[model samples]
Target: MCTYATVQTTLEGSAKGPEGSWFAVTDATVYFDHPVHALAEHTLNIDFADPAKGPGARVAVELTAAAARDLLSAIQEALDSAPAELTA
Candidate 1:
């Protein structure tokens, strides 16, 4: 089993394709802002389809430039509030 530590956050949105409406708890998504700024933007986009093996996995990350930064920053709040344990 993969350690939960790898996942810095969990996105509770809709994930389309393959898995259909399933929860997707993924690892951290690290990236920079721009070529000029380069490493100036260090953010991670963590998310999950659902709390369990249910529906709601039908989402995608569609952003542009600075918008990406905003979306990532916004997800930070969810990360800070996610639990480190599996729920029953």
Candidate 2:
């Protein structure tokens, strides 16, 4: 079953895309849905994109549920270990 629930937000960052090119990313869309390339039936999908640059300017990731949770924990741990000034 697909949740069809997507959380979209604006972000400021850079992502390296195809052709070994880098682009500025201004949008982030995250959702749990069917995977496009992953072997799993369903996965957590994230797309970092720059809408102004068209569809090709994007970076995507799809992770299994377990992997997603582990990634989340790792991110939190890294943030926790970093200095407050640097994270801020």
Output the number of the TM-score-best candidate.
2
Query: What lDDT does each candidate get?
Result: 0.42, 0.93
lDDT of 1 by residue, 2-84 (tens): 22233335443344434453334543232322222234333222333343443443232324447767766887866767784
- Cα-lDDT of candidate 1: 0.42
Model 1: what TM-score?
A: 0.30
Give the TM-scores of the predictions, in the order they appear. 0.30, 0.93
Q: Give the 10-residue window scoring lowest on summed lDDT in candidate 2.
A: 12-21
**Global Cα lDDT for candidate 2:** 0.93
Q: Please list the residue runs of candidate 2 whose C-alpha ends up more than 4 Å from where it truly belongs after superposition.
A: none
Q: What is the lDDT of residue 27 in candidate 1?
A: 30
Off by over 4 Å in 1: 1-14, 18-61, 84-88
